[model samples]
Target: MNERVNGLSETAVKLDRAGLDGMDRAPPQLDRLEREFQTFMREVDEAAAQLRLKAKPIWFGPVKADIDAESALLKDERRKDPPQQEADAKIIQPERLDPSQENGKFAAGSLKSMDADTGPVRAQPQPSGAPKMGEAEKAEGGSSDVFHRRLGPINLADNLQAGIRAVRRNLLVVMGFTLATNVLVLAIPVYLFQISDRVLTSRSTDTLVMLTILIAGAVILNAVLDAIRRFILMRTAVEVAAQLGAPILGAAARASLHSNGREYQTLGDLQQLRSFLVSGTLLSFLDAPLTPLFMLAVFLVHPDLGYIAVVAALLLLVIAFINQKMTASAFHEAGNFQSRANLHLDSMSRNSQIINALAMIPEAVKIWGQDTAGSLKAQVLAQDRNVISASVSKAVRMLAQVAMLGWGAYLSLEGQLTGGMVIAASIIAGRALAPVEGAIEGWHQFIHTRSAYERISVLLKSSPLNFERLKLPRPQGRLDVERLLFVPQGTKRVVLNGVSFTLAAGESLAVIGDSGAGKTTLGKMLVGSLLPTSGNVRLDLMDLRNWDQRQFGENIGYLPQDVQLFPGTIKANIGRMRDDASDEDIYKAARLADVHELISTFAQGYETMVAADGSPLSGGQKQRIALARAFFGNPRLVVLDEPNSNLDGSGDAALLRALSHAKREKITVITITQRPSLLNCVDKILLLSNGTVAMFGVREEVLKALAPLNATNGRPAVASQTPQVA
Candidate 1:
């Protein structure tokens, strides 16, 4: 079942690589090789898993096979007997004895006695499921897929139209400078063409001096103008990238609650958007039609030769296009190989101890190699195409040059063209070829940038969560849910079916349910992270959607399951959402989150910078920073999702104290917890069951309803009693 091909395996992998220096070196080639190896390992892993399954071929038991055959034979025999006339009338409602009630519970086990849909659903019952969806609190940033499919090429006409329409005063001034610079640059070529011919014919000193001065002036002006153009371009590119990235980052933020982002997305995807804005969109405008203009002009002067030049260039480019089309499947294969290869590497690195103990290093490498080989082959084929194309173009250019030299010799001898003219024509032809290759390069760049641009656009274009907008009510921590139904992700069963609950402001509420129960989804809706498909969620007598973001943000303090910290001083992070807050305010918030002491212990105290995404901090430390962020605006509602995940004992107690302090500050706290101890701390509990509130009331009352649904290690004592939330 091990699919790794030996013999050439070691030879195929070129582990040691020489760095690029002087000639005979390239870095990208080595990188490609390494990537291919990694890709092979990924392929080997997947294939090995599949082949292992195949190797253990299933053998239908002899008796079972015979039973199946006999069953078929008996069915045929039954068919040969005339079909029973009353076969369809075999419905039976067998009489059953009712079971006795054991204590307050119904002890009868027969499913036939139960009528699940016999009456109206409970209008106001308690919720019993655990509120927290996952035990771990997540970091603050949202993850997403790497490649987002675009809706064809972007219609730039809209952006272009708007740009022209919104031609602001500053932009017009910059445009004028750009136009003036272009005019000056274009005039140089014309000047050269005219002066070269005239100087060759007459050899006038005055003419030469003037031409020299003109060229110098043009060069100087062009450089200065280009600097300005670059400045403008930078501004424009940043504006566009931001215009594209902000909404995308926003969407990613919006999607963070439901998506863990492991499938196919990363921060790199968003960076691609920025890159495309600066390079791809701006450069592609020249990719079309410019060649035709040059060809038309050339044809007017030399009908046959111009046509040949155009034909040859066009034919060369056509080959490149064909090669690109052929590489699509290869590129896709390469991408898959790359992803799996990376995963393999990550797994190997993270589980080095496991591999070391098993002494499976060679096997691990071999597996990685197996995953990556196909992609390597594809890439090798692609590289071959590129090299061959380059070599062919070089060959073709040689032929054309030979022809040009021969033609030029005859024309010079006949006195139809001068030696200098022949040289000039040859130079012009070479210039034409330079751009042809550049055109192809430009095309390649376009495809890359376009790919990235499309991803950013998708993030921007998605529909936001639905929340009905209503006027703001001073949040008093009170909440109510009536006739609520929730379907947790990846399951057919509902976690909360016909659930209802109510809570007073400045009070604490705990949601408890089975692991898959819709506890997290319910909490998410309350925090404006998700919208219910078929119900209304209101906050403080106002619809969530009705309030502008500023108002909602100012009033609702939501702590996500994952707490992500930006790379900055502790004070800076707390003051981020409240720009006007001073150092004292940030310190106060940090103190409330119980992280001020930790900040003080750092070498820089409150000024110590956290590495990007808080890599320097432990999970517990990161969560506290996030809690500090939640407290920034003195919001009335404190919604915590698994805040105690990384804390233990005294830490947990301290976190609970913070929650209690929030309540004392008149801020309502709704927390999701699976721990029984945390439940005891809350005033009320909403126990969720089968996508409905099983019970809702004071903690003791809700616990009574959920007594039958207690679980161990997150699984129900009985399968049917468990809610399918995940």
Candidate 2:
């Protein structure tokens, strides 16, 4: 190996020395390119490092060395870990509208978390089996129950009734104005026909002057009434829209948990229905309805020709019916395509950042483009049918008018119909056919609009969170879990099996566990966010199943893991309801949560609007605000899930101080967390294992049982107290 290397170096040196070789070192451009490539690689590595990955270890009992690999998404439920099996059932929809989960978190660094303003909404445990607070704690500070409004059923006649009322009032006020304009409009041709028959026949100027005045008056009259009609029509549309929007969302909010909790589809259908109301009545009114009114006014003046006009309308209707029936299926399909394409575009917009980041731009664009193209293609076909339909209808209308004109002329020549009558009849016949043309346009729009309304309605009627057979009085905050069976609400996984514990008023319990320990699930059940499949969460002497809905909501305050902040003034967000809260009270809560300083620094201070979950603030700042919102109600019990996850040391210290304050106030604080600092402040700890109580009792006593496993490589004898795990 050394001789061969020496020969290659020697050959290169000899060749260079002989001046046969061009260079001895790499080029400057190559060095620059190499440096640039390295920089790019560094960036890619940093970006890749930020990706989130969930993993679980598999250990063959007492096995020596464990192999590391990516954790697989749980498949074949029968073989999955119990926790994973439970989670699988809880997922709302595997095929969801939002595709962000397919890859992971937002590709645009970190997404700002959304915190819903719970405001005065308390999530007290249900009476069915949810734990309750004692009388002492309840008397100290109690929250208000959730208010549900009654939403009546939708009757088909409701809309038409509204329309009839509006139109009648409008017509009463405008009909006289319309009549004056109509008479003026009719007088022009009538005067001309009379002049040709009388004045021109007799060479007179009286009718000529009258004809001039009538045409000018007709224009003036229309200009005035048309303005009023336009405003009234617009007002009518607004009234209709307002009436439909209100009862929907409010009704959905009031629906019984058991009745429509599964009908999430109802809300989407209702939205579609409202859209139909907008396009069907308002747009079509101007497009087609006016034509019929004009036709009707003319027919009233000329019966001799109106009969011929009526015949023409019948022919037109026959043609229109044939055309509509033949193309109805295609138009319906087009409407559906447009709706789907619109939804597709919305999905694309939300995931644009991820698609662009991973060079999946073309794929995303392709999906959107396909839908758009299909929609456009359907529209073009529908447009063709419409045009053909319109042409056929128009031809028949013109034929009827021409035939009427000929019949009128023949009658006048025979002295059966007068000359003025012939002219008036012809005009009247054309006007009568106007409404038929309007129907075609109105019918199409009505279908699409109705479709939209139906979709929106479905969305509005979606089922609320279910809490069946839970009708007991509110708890007083005494929670008992006696040999309770743990059943995952979404999935059938057993997080806690035969677990037993008791939470008394004025006591704080800190539950510390690793991820997948079912800590969050238990917290949710306690706070009414979720219901247990089989376990009994008893309150005082009774089960939560028997609790009253309204009263239960007032007793407990819950802070979920994902905080949702509403977009509004800080004061509005924090105080929410109970606007009666004093400025000092809000500031105290803010200061406790450590968000007072952060919010006060904004331009508007507490009045400042928080856009998109307080984008102006950092994660810790937003979290502080959420914490403040949670404690605003001063309920009997507070259940917090990972409240300190994003807080810095300072923020965390402030949070602990606030929790200490809550304890001092004699509030029952149940915390789900993994933070060690929480262990020091809690009155006791509950250790959960395999959906069962691994350990429970005072913090000092329970910690002794977990000490053996918590011991380091060089620690003294650790465990002292041990509570047996079932």
Candidate 3:
């Protein structure tokens, strides 16, 4: 062992000397040295293993001393030449060695001559047909793929399936309870049979008392189990709601965006689904499958009685099928009419003030009444059919019970069955048919719930939930629009086309055009509220569509033509309803919008509650607050459409101040306006004519070009074209 160690030390010294002298060693010599080093390492490993095995024995002391001495010698040698030892450590570090380099003639650190001249080893060229590390994991669908799968599809069916999976254990437990409950249902019939066969025949008071107590106990236990089953179902409904509510709402919101102002009833649909979960209708469906078990029980009592129960159940099912066929179309029509009527009523309610002032209530009511009347007529037809079917089903059930009793009595008289068996058969037969009757009675509810489920599924499929995007750094306010084009959904009319422009960081541009020039649409595309049919809107060279929505929103501020505030405190509205927003941010936004003093005059100041309709605050106040909301968090870009339309003189002055503040902060600004006041504050002007760019250049240049047209037309050229821009 000592001789081997000496030989290894001598070889290392020779290698270090060769490296210090910068001698270019041949590949063969380096390979030979590498083989020797590997053999020495293997020997050291074998010696360590032997020492470990001998560690527990009395002879281990000499081996332990030899191990320590070897370790000390290695440490002393490492200290003698720290830099060389460091290079050796690098060679031994598994992570530092490139696996691809292993196939080359010289292994890592095999050429000691290069160690003195090179800083770190370079990666070797990979062999042909070999996958890079990243490509290999990508091919195997690694962590990123797993993340995407976890996101899943945002459709209703997948979300519902996920929710069901989450509660699968609870569902299994509920099924167990249902089975026990159904089995306990036989206690009534058994008690009746015992009373007639034992107590009546014996004429024993003690027997009657014992039978009463047993029947009472069974009834009590059955009720307890039923209660527990209902309780579990109710809790399951809540859990499902908690799991699905947010995703459903998010999908609905996205659906609304692409729906051309069509409103979705998704929340109502979700509520209906939750209601169905805990309804008696669900319990009836659950028990319907167990009907055959009850029929089997009746068969055990008497084969003739079992046959009667089966026929009755089959008859009721046939009736249910008939009822569904008779009313399905009517229920579907009613649902459509009801949805239309609701949408009409909601629109009317939002415009109630206008309707009343313009004496349009009668016209509005007439239109709404037509839709309501159709809905009611369809509902009436469905109800009529439902009632008739239910009545017939009830009659059939009663007659079946009577027939069972009559047959049992005849069999008893024939000396084939006991009297106690007669009443028991009647009760058990009724229990078997109860679920079928319940199904008939609740058929309308089942239809409605099924329709709701289908509608929700369609809504989700039409507008899938947004997946998480990678967060990019905050933008520096540079804007680029490249040949952007937009056509509204479901229409052939092009709203905007071939609109292209650029704005450096902190530059401001005013968009001026005719009434139908697509200015609002362009604004929406710029802020990513509306997607373009082609081309791109880029901020900091990253496409707007690719930016993480929440992060992107944080960097951009937008005030639309109609400024509608959300229902919350003034402070919340300014902070975009984020709970984490600090008071300082809210105040800063308020001050930037120049509405801080107006807000302070309010009794609640920043805490003042505001409605969605902008009550308690005037139109000017609402517009100003909305401006503040857009300016919140010191957004890199701000877009304002008709910002001063409702502003008074003071409000207009405040708007100018806000624009000046934005300029000082180097925030990019885009305003859609026909007002000369706004144009004066902008660096450039984009004149849109019929959705196409008419002129785009420095503000003074564009205005000078329009000067002749204004003089010739006897009016301001932009304002004459845009009569709707107040």
Winner by lDDT: 3
| Structural similarity to truth (TM-score) of each candidate | 0.61, 0.61, 0.77
Q: List RMSD in Å for every model shown.
A: 32.6, 28.0, 16.8
Q: Taking the tens digit of each residue's C-alpha lDDT, what string does model 2 give over 153-235?
A: 23323433464476567655555554555445565566656776787787768767776687677777777776665566556
Clash tally for model 2 = 69
lDDT of 1 by residue, 1-726 (tens): 233344225434433333234225445655665676687778877665444332211112123224664466446535644343123222212121112322333343421231243321211221111112111111211111011122111232233233333324335555566555645644454555556578867889898888888878987897897667556656765665444444444456656556553223423554554464345334323223244544554454345446556666776677668756755555556656755776687668656867999999999998889778866876666556655665666666556656665676577787766565555455445445544555444443444445545554454444353222222323434455546666657776665566666555556887776776777777777777776655655555455655544446656676777677777777777766345666765766776777777677788887778876575778887788788888765566778888888876767777877776676665677887776657756778776665676667876666654555455346454332223211
Off by more than 4 A, model 2: 1-195, 202-204, 208-226, 246-308, 318-367, 410-415, 418-420, 456-502, 510-556, 577-581, 597-609, 683-726
Q: Candidate 1 or 2, higher TM-score?
A: 1
Model 3 weakest 10-residue run by lDDT:
141-150
Question: Relative to the unseen true structure, what is the Cα RMSD of model 3?
Answer: 16.8
lDDT of each structure?
0.56, 0.59, 0.78
Evaluated at residue 572, the lDDT of candidate 3 is 95
Question: In candidate 3, what are the lDDT values of residues 331-409, reduced to their tens digit?
Answer: 9999889888888888897788799999999999998999999999999999999999999999998899898899989
lDDT of 2: 0.59
lDDT of 3 at 108: 39
By lDDT, highest first, what's the ranking?
3, 2, 1
